[model samples]
Target: MLWRRRAGMNGESDLAIHGATPGENIDESVRALACARHLPQPHLDRWLAMNERSRAAFLEIAQTLRLRTGQITAALELLEEISVRDATDCADILAAPEIARIRLHAGSAPARARELIETLRARRFPRLRETSTRLAGAIRELRLPRGISVVLPRELRSDVLTITVEVARVAELDGAIEALAARRAAIARIIEMLGGSE
Candidate 1:
């Protein structure tokens, strides 16, 4: 019956019963140990033996609890870093709206608009490369298009070459923003669970 009761307590309950609630329990247990110092050796030995299985179970539970807690903490820290980086990227995008607007404006002369578009494309190349690399790695195991082409001006005309690369670039930027938002949300949830905040 004692063994059955011990088994029913599982591991976490044993730790709780051992008074491992934080700082108070440790000090309490220390005082208890000092008082027990005067007890007979045989009685102490038998008591420890009787609690051996409970101790083992509690140790296992403590290890797992610490490991999971550490993992969650690390993950939250990483997400915070990602959120900051993503916010910086978003700020860059926000500051560069003029570039995309210039590319989209139909009244802008083709040569001038083309120059602005080319500049925007060059500026975005590094970010696009990073995003594409991640996407490529994710899709490597599946069969998909190796590359996609978008028509400029979105209108088909042999004489008038109207193709805006900015559209695709903007889409990629939006996707990156969305990805960051999702990561931030996930991090927020973990932080809430761990009793932290943004």
Candidate 2:
């Protein structure tokens, strides 16, 4: 037997129970966890144990709930940190009842605990992730022999770059200047690739 709370078109919630074989129970339970507005603890635990898809669905529902409750910024940030794998196997995170429990225990503002479960979802998109990785690698490869540190512009915008060069005397200053001069073309190319005009 599996139990779920269903919301009707009239905005009322009803307890829906299904009695069936174990496999059927699991399916019904997963469905309930995916759609239910409120999750009872025991049922949440059962839903967490079902399978990967069910856990992912539960996390999605939890995210929706957070958004509807005006935790938009926090929810967006949390989405960046949450992964489907964490949603499936990590009971302390992406588990609705557990999140609610943590919320109560921490006495923090809404969506505070959820931040801990956030995964870098931007890295999941192949093109964006690939571009970011390539850009970072290219930047690292431009390291100067004098240990000049190149700071990437925030958001990779390429408008402003900060280069740190350590020099203790006049001779080192000349070397640093020459090193930077040598790398000027490479740096310009990198900036162009990042969508900035030299």
Candidate 3:
């Protein structure tokens, strides 16, 4: 289970499983108990203090929502594309409602994972994503040079932009740069399309 920090009854901080319904299995409970046995004194104290129902729920939540290594890695990579603050906020939000919703859905895990990421990305960076989409549309209208690509910052902290120009030879480099520069006004129009810079 991926550990989440939660406030304890005494106002101290500790790691606990966040989402548990009554849908736990005996096997999972046994595994959880085994794991609990190896925990340090303070953590073990908290675990042992839980009532049977609470302990059972904890075990169930831990088993059911445990993120696999691949899922964790993918989520980290996805979050890396955004601001650190947004990443932290997304993680805090994902710990509960999103995890529960995704778990209850009927679909391929990968598909659901993609959906979760896209949804979170949109939520966390609505304006930036919208700006990027509109910028792509505007750039498409220009029929950009094959050797050039436009890249926007995930979070638009400023109006600064990057246009990548790829060329095989020195002769084509100037042409590629010029072609991209020719579309500057069109690219600039994206702020208007997005209803002003966000």
130-161, model 1: which lDDT tens digit per residue?
Answer: 44344334333222222322121211112222
Question: Which numbered prediction scores highest in TM-score against the true structure?
Answer: 3
Superposed Cα deviation of residue 86, candidate 3 (Å) = 15
Clashes of 2: 5
**lDDT for each of the candidates?**
0.34, 0.52, 0.53
Against the true structure, candidate 1 has what lDDT? 0.34
Which candidate tops lDDT?
3
The TM-score between candidate 3 and the true structure equals 0.45
Clashes of each: 4, 5, 0
lDDT of 2 by residue, 1-198 (tens): 254545556433333446665445545555554455354454445545535543444443443344332233343234333445344233333434444443334444335434433332332344545666776787788877765777777656555667788989998889989988998988777777677333
For model 1, what is the error of residue 196's alpha carbon versus the real structure, in angstroms, after optimal superposition?
29
Candidate 1: RMSD to truth: 26.4
Q: For model 1, which pairs clash?
A: 152-162, 152-163, 152-164, 153-162
**Collision count of model 3:** 0
> Where in model 3 is the C-alpha error above 4 Å?
1-66, 69-107, 190-198
TM-score of each: 0.15, 0.42, 0.45
TM-score, predicted candidate 1 vs. hidden true structure: 0.15
